[model samples]
Target: MSEITPADFALFLLASGDMQPRKRARDQQADLAGLELKRHVLDLIVSYAPPADALEATLMQIAQEIGPPYGPTRALCASIRDEFADAASTPGFMEWLIEEAVRENAGQKEKRRGKTFNQ
Candidate 1:
């Protein structure tokens, strides 16, 4: 199984609202169990109601720890941090996130296929 990274966690958070249904969808199937564990950890932090800056710091720390291929870049982490709250409160934000994740995943899969074929 592929290791989940901070980017995956952030994507999970952004799409969490529809996770259950997405998990059941064939094309959307992913390591939901692993993502759930990450979600639980995030929930623990959120329960403390950390200030925005602190929350962003914590997220950046996670990204650094998970650095590289799957890990998000500092810019991506900042974007995710800035958008996290709106993802929960803004209508349709979750849908947009899910769609973006799917699109990105599809593109990555295609790249992998190309690499394999070329090799």
Candidate 2:
């Protein structure tokens, strides 16, 4: 393989978030089943977040890797969600809005690409 630049590494870290570290810290004991579940959860979220909801995809992936309900990343996501919820009167409905936005954008992108799904 070719040498990876710091810029490339930074982008990968930004994209992968906690997954790299967690996978590396316990390669032998890492929960493969849990990770599989996490990926399923992420894909589910992505299915919901069509186009502009790319941010939500990033959120779900990062949250899952940050490790379940007790990890710092999970807590951070919760806090962010709580704050976002407080911004509205109907409580934490940001997820739904995100999904709708995703669907709308995804529809547009699909039409442009002349294909369905993550082209």
Candidate 1 lDDT: 0.55
Give Cα distance to truth, residue 29, candidate 1, Å. 34
Candidate 2, residue 105: Cα displacement in angstroms equals 24
Our tally of clashes for model 2 stands at 1
Best by lDDT: 1
Error of 1 at 66 (Å): 12
Candidate 2 lDDT tens digits, 1-119: 23322223222322342232253455544465544544444444344443332444455566766565646455444443343334344443434444555566666677888764546
Tens-place lDDT per residue, model 1, 1-91, is 2333334445456444433434354654345654554554455445444555466777666556556643334554565565666654677
TM-score per candidate? 0.39, 0.25
Clashes of 1: 0
